[model samples]
Target: MSAQAVDGLSRRGLLKFSVGATAFLATAGVTASLSGCSSSDTAPGFDALRTSDLPFLLAVIPVMLDGALTGIPSQSATERTLHGLDSGLSHLSPEMLKLTRQLFDVLGMAITRGPLTGIWSPWENAEPGQIRHFLGRWENSSLELLRQGHSSLLQLVLMAWYSQPQSWAGCGYPGPPKI
Candidate 1:
């Protein structure tokens, strides 16, 4: 075929495309630069605002944890709450949609495949320290990968977090306990 066809998506073409994509984003804007978010208001250099905003916390938590699960279905509130959110969030950006697919698959496996025999999620052993460690590590990696701007996949993830409204109450997170 004289290498004229296949639109260069052949192995050689893919390599070329990858290199071009990386260089383009590297030379792109600084909006792509990001930093990890600390877990609580009490954390050093953390934001003290929004302690009352339960929904915001929930919306942010899973993303802070795994760089995904920003759109998981809820079981925390009444059926009506679930129904309302189900309709409103019926469509997510392609990136969030992809993460939703991944999380749902994990949920399905955890349910059907049964625990211990199913995939082992580090979260299963979560204590405050362990959760903090995992969340910090994931967010650090997410932001670092984002700042590098050489990988399309992590940039897509950053978009998913930024594009969504950071409100968990809308997703059925009731207000947090009074301290």
Candidate 2:
């Protein structure tokens, strides 16, 4: 059976876009990995997140969680959230995991990160406004890949924090009837 085509884009166009996106991701991951920059070493006590991921997450969580983190000691809450993210991400299907690692790889390395995200400084040195600009750029980008990447990162961070018991009180959720 022939595949049904979308109204505006021809199958060849769709195929070209898919191949380009895949090639871009592969290039990003391979470049980052070969640069000896995207360390596979996990963050302290983290099973999934690499050391390279820490600074990015640390800088992002504050802005992403804004009011949700009020009253919590920033450092402790961030650590807990990262730990939860590691735990949660460890259970993702292998394909999802690879996609996530690719996203992290792209964001972790200087070459791809600067061009793609418009944040020239390293994640550790990125200011709130810079991070905001990057996130906004990706979230509202015309590229589907960028938007999907933004959504994936946002969902992971939010789920990680909200899954933790410490965050329950912030959302008015009791401890599951003491079970």
Candidate 3:
């Protein structure tokens, strides 16, 4: 019953498309699984993310949390952020965890990652400009799934960063007042 329209698709239509797209992507993931593309050795310090997915999230954190990360040593900031993200992810519901893993898998695959995210190079080799373009495309995409992916990534990075005491100073938020 919503009146809003995005790119001429009604809100209901968009929701339907999003559901259908997710189903299709889920199916694609299953198909890709048969090719042995879903398995990756665990990263050294991460619990929820595979070794291959870490670089993509690393590439994303700086871009998504730019102002907050400024002046911090890149290596230290990245490690802290990754640790925070891993901690937060440990609490996700099973369904959410599955969807997140699927997203990571899509980003880790060369053929799909380039076309879907527009960052063709390995994350370490990717320029900030390329990462920004990829973010912009997802945030502004007509497809609801892409927009949701953008929102999910942005929220995850911001939540993980802002939850840290060190990040509070940048955002002008002091710690909770004593009782």
Please list all clashing residue pairs in model 1, or write none if there are none. 55-168, 55-169
Candidate that would win on lDDT: 2
Query: What C-alpha lDDT do the candidate models reach, one value each?
Result: 0.35, 0.83, 0.77
lDDT of 3 by residue, 1-179 (tens): 34454545776787787788778666666655557777645677778767767878888787777667656776677678888888888789967877777787777777777878787877888888899999999999888788888899888877887778777777778888989
Encode model 1's per-residue lDDT on 30-115: one tens digit a residue: 11212212122222222222222223233323433352334444332222232333333345565654333332222223232133
What C-alpha root-mean-square deviation, in Å, does candidate 2 show against the real structure?
4.9
Q: Assess every candidate by TM-score.
A: 0.26, 0.83, 0.81
Taking every candidate in turn, the Cα RMSD to the unseen true structure, in Å, is 17.4, 4.9, 4.7
List candidate 1 segments past 4 Å from native: 1-88, 93-95, 103-124, 142-179
1 against 2, candidate with superior lDDT:
2
* Tens digits of lDDT, candidate 2, 41-116: 7777778888888777888888888789757887788888888899988899978877788788888777788978
Which clashing pairs does model 2 show? none
lDDT of 2: 0.83
